[model samples]
Target chain A: MERLGSGGREGARRIGEVLTWDPLVRLTHWSVALLVLLNGAVLEDEGQPHVWVGYAVLGLVAARFLWGLVGPARARFTSFPPSLSAARLHVDEVMHGRERRHESHNPLGALMAYNLWATLLAICATGLMMESVAFFGVEWVEEAHEALFAWLMISVGLHVSGVILESFLSGRNLVRAMVGSFHKRSGGGA
Target chain B: MKLAPFALALAFAASPVIAQEVAQGDKIGTEIGAIASALSERGYEVRKTEREDGKVEVYAVREGRRFEIYVDPETGAVTRVKEKH
Candidate 1:
């Protein structure tokens, strides 16, 4: 087996450690991301293709919601339940420049992930409702859906910024780990 | 008498205008009602309908108004459905 860390150093114990995310978890994460982006950018157009894409996004969201409960370790909601106090403390750590690197999501990052999923669900529900005749042409429903899209974009931007900041702070390329399923550092903060 | 001539002219002039309005109203009402029923069969409730200049205006409530679906009166096809703001 490959040694978990470099040079058998103490700090190296957490460095160069590789913990793989299960295939289901990875698929759910990327599918949700792509669907959200598609719904926001391309589905608003007046065409049959747009409607089909909207339906596909709805299906993807439904699948991901179910997976959150039954999926593997890192993907399970139980694995990373949100805690307000923990998030606040994490925020403080960031401010004080003493935040610890996490193998998985940090408290603040967990909160963002939760919000992103919830917002996507809301958007999908509202979008589906709009297609029904009773709700069709209702101004408020349309407006609510659009508003959720705006919020989703903001949350995604914040999430990206957090990932970049963490990568620098921890001295590892977090984005690369997400793609390649391995990190240069041994610490498996995910 | 002078009054008889004026009354006759007035009735003639007003007849076409009144007939046109009624015809337009009937067409809009029938078309909108049919469309609303079709949508209702597909699970939608029509909330309001109006005949404006040359188009029929329809408003509907679906899923407790979480979203609104709009339809074109002329073709009785869906225009768009959007979430309520």
Candidate 2:
């Protein structure tokens, strides 16, 4: 997974020198972000555009699920399996000031990633239910969709905060890494 | 500095800015049962009635199609009927 970024020292270096997010990962990430923002803030909630955007988000998530299985080593779910113990250990290490820098996603980040994906799936499901004739005007389903959307927003805020915190701790520009092709190298263990 | 016209245009274009103010007087027929009965008279099986703004939104079904009827609570008049697809 560590080698998944650069391949070798002599590969492409468009923006910087490291590649943390692959094309599929970056595409899905930004697409989901834009679609969610459009649906939540810009478009009318019950409008056709909002429904289409929701479907697009669901499609992006579905594609990401497949990519997690057959994509690069860094993008795979196995690379950062959700583990409560691992997340606790990461938090403990952070508290003790002995946290090791992970080249891929850290434990807490992995959990957040899984949380966002699952929450998005739930939101999409509820949204679809609301569209169906059987579930039309179903108050609980609409409420569940609204609740999941709130959770997604909260997860996004936490994810960005964690990224900034990790960047400071590990001396890596994660935002830049996501934008371009390279993450600044920092000496730490996974 | 000189982009006031463009900015105003953009603001209106991006306006999520429709505001409707409903008068909240003593409603004559605002009860859920009353709304359900009113909808039942229209050949609808009333499932739920929710008070939204100054209107009662009745979710009802007739045959197979679902309908959302917005009714004036004071007048008991159906303001709008939206078929839920």
Local distance difference test, per candidate?
Answer: 0.63, 0.76
- Candidate 2 Cα deviation (angstroms), residue B2: 88
CA lDDT, candidate 2, residue A8: 30
**RMSD for each of the candidates:** 12.0, 15.9
Give one digit per residue, the lDDT tens place, for model 1 in A135-180. 5656688789889989999998999999898778766666654554
Interface RMSD of each: 5.0, 1.4
Best DockQ goes to which candidate? Answer: 2
Grade the docking of candidate 2: acceptable
Q: lDDT at A2 for candidate 2? A: 38
- Scanning candidate 2 chain A in windows of ten residues, the lowest lDDT window is A8-17
User: lDDT tens digits, residues B6-72, model 2?
Assistant: 9998888766433221223323255678767645654667776788898888777777777777878
Q: Candidate 1: where is the Cα deviation over 4 Å?
A: A1-20, A181-190, B1-85
